[model samples]
Target: MEKTVMIDGKQVQFKSNGATPLKYKMQFRKDFFAEILKLHKLGKLKNLDEIDDDVLGTLDFEVFYNIAWTFAKTADSSLPDPETWLESFNEFPIFDFISELQEMIMANIQSKKK
Candidate 1:
């Protein structure tokens, strides 16, 4: 699956495909599915104030950026490293956009049964 979202007035394309997981693992040196599951805890919360400090303390917020970058990289092979790519954007409204990515991530993992 592919999506184009506007960030800081620029159109950014993100892709999730057969190679997405592998790209994520290779770039971040972390299991894509495992990292994704970590975000599930945040998804269950009614608000940030409701977070359990014990869990929030250990959460790597960078995972959010890494996941976004991985999908962006998958869409455009020539994109620079994550940091540089992110720097190009004046504002990256990740919180607003992550939910969209969550759906794409889920679709990537689902299998079509005939």
Candidate 2:
């Protein structure tokens, strides 16, 4: 799946290549589960209706950065690193972009389950 969002007055593109590779999955497992546990414990993710804007606002950028870097195929290929790439944006809609990414991943998982 693919999505385009305006960031820093530029149209940034993001894509999800279905299920992530096992290697990347394993690499991010601890951090992924940690975030999930943290959100659940904070009652920000117990259910769709329970998501709190305050809690979501506190989420770190690591998870989003990892996912974005793993899937980003920007036109400029000389960004040095993900951090630099992300930093290039003057105003990044982190929350909105991450939400879209999560939905893509969840949808992919659900489709495979059926």
Candidate 3:
């Protein structure tokens, strides 16, 4: 609340105020993204090629695209809610499916070399 958070040896401001409501969240996001873009313009954004290991978080875009595309792929299936679908992905079969796919690809590659 009173103290500043340090980044690259510079003190950044902090606030202990309650979270903003969902209605205003989008505006906040726009402002946040705008600030990111501004900093990027100001040459403050970190280099993607040389990002720190601790800051590198896993992102499975294929899983996300699969979930989104499935609804579009099926002519009659109801579109899946992104939030709930994401929850389901974290819960089960998706990870297993990806594992099986990895094995299948490995086997196919091995088979082709023979």
Candidate with best lDDT: 1
Please tell me which predicted candidate would have the highest TM-score against the true structure: 1
Q: Per-residue lDDT tens digits of candidate 2, residues 14-49?
A: 665534434236545654334433333232244445
Clashing pairs in 1: none
Q: Give the higher-TM-score candidate: 2 or 3.
A: 2
Candidate 1 wrongly placed segments (more than 4 Å): 45-55, 111-114
Across residues 1-114, which tens digit of lDDT does each residue of candidate 1 receive?
Answer: 889888889989999888888999889899998888777765555555666878688667788899889999989999999999999998997655766677787876667877
lDDT of 1 at 106: 82
* Better candidate by TM-score, 1 or 3: 1
- Segments of candidate 3 deviating more than 4 angstroms: 1-76, 88-90, 100-114
> Against the true structure, what is each candidate's TM-score?
0.83, 0.56, 0.23
- CA lDDT scores, all candidates in order: 0.83, 0.54, 0.30
lDDT of 3 at 19: 28
